[model samples]
Target chain A: MTGYLNIILRLTIWFLLTADLSWANIVIGVGVTILLPRGVTNVGLLKDWLRTLGEVAVAIPQAYKEAFEIMLYPHREETVVLERVKPRRTPSLIFLDIFLITFTPKTIVQRYHSRGWYEVHYIQRRETP
Target chain B: MINILSYTCIILGLVFWYWGTWPLLGRRSVLYKLHGLSVADTLGSMAIVVGLLLRIPHEWPLLVLALISLSIWNTVLGYVLAYCVTDDGTHDVGQEVGHGG
Candidate 1:
């Protein structure tokens, strides 16, 4: 029941965002919602997903803040640092991490190293000499 | 009042777009350039869409879709590009880990 409700809510939001009331759009939206791949489903633990979502929400605002800071203050040059992250669980979580971080202009995923580390490019303000 | 905010957002978005581009011309590494370009581009595009959303409230549905696509599709494209460009043919982690499945 909850899953169905979730699907309905997502479809409604999709329709509202698209602002299309046409039957074709509605049918397509419903089909896409229902046909979402099973691997893309929640990663087994609701709590972990919620925690990750909260982290992403927080990161978003911070990213915006960083974007403005970088643009407004060009004197402070930004440097890209490669950081390694190892997620014990599924690789999907790593993708989520990459997606959330990349959403902001502050950090992005550069590469996934075979050594179980993600090469993350972090934009940092360089310290004055 | 709303108009003022919308214009401000659009201008800010442009600033971000420029910010992203500036790094590209600099001496940064390719990964850094990619990072700067993608992040700034995505944020700026989203901000522009938001400004449009405010200006044309009637067309919000389309604007929101644009916003969603900008975020999702853009990120995915960036990931693919980064993966392809940075892949040294030595690392098989992506194939081994299997993303999006």
Candidate 2:
């Protein structure tokens, strides 16, 4: 499933870049996607993938809100907290998790400990009640 | 209506860009500055691309691609920067300072 998704993602990028729908273009896109080297394949659950997607969608609005909060409160308190990674997450999902955490303004994953912990840097308004 | 909306988005994106970037001038930890930079750079740029898409519907594919890549690349870059900087013994220093302040 991940492999198919990878192919589709590459094909979408190729189509967008070329802005072409010709048979030749489609053939070349497919050829390139096939030729591209993929790393170790980890079979991740589709349920996990969908949940990550939902988090991504939710993060957009939350990001905007966080941005506003950061802007309003320039003076912030910073701290590093150890966060646990969800059990059985594939590499792609782990990558997505890190991305989602860092995408927001309030927190960033500083380091990923091999023992399923993320050293997350968090920021918040100093005057928060 | 669309024109106004697109302009608003573009302007809003610019505001976010500044909001996120202005913190770099502060005397804060690297991670703090990175948080602001990543949020602004990625989200602001995405907003600008979204506005462009609204203005030029004909170029939806390219603009959409831009949005996707911008978010993914910026987020990854932020994580990489944070990871690299904190890997050394500097993390202890940062922790101490954070607690002190």
Q: Best-fitting candidate, measured by lDDT?
A: 2
Interface DockQ of each model: 0.30, 0.47
Specify the CAPRI tier of model 1. acceptable
Q: How does each model score on TM-score?
A: 0.71, 0.88
Q: Against the native chain B, what TM-score does each candidate's chain B reach?
A: 0.81, 0.87
True contacts kept of each: 0.38, 0.57
lDDT of 1 by residue, A26-108 (tens): 89998888777543343435566577768877976787887777666553333333455644544566677778767766556
> Which candidate wins on DockQ?
2
Q: What lDDT does each candidate get?
A: 0.67, 0.82
Residue pairs with clashing backbones, model 1: A17-B61
Interface RMSD score of each model: 8.4, 4.8
Q: Where in model 2 is the C-alpha error above 4 Å? A: A1-5, A127-129, B88-101
DockQ of 1: 0.30
Clashing residue pairs found in predicted model 2: none
Residue lDDT tens for model 1, B1-101: 99999999899888878878887888755656766676567888888889989999988777777777677777877777767766554432222222221
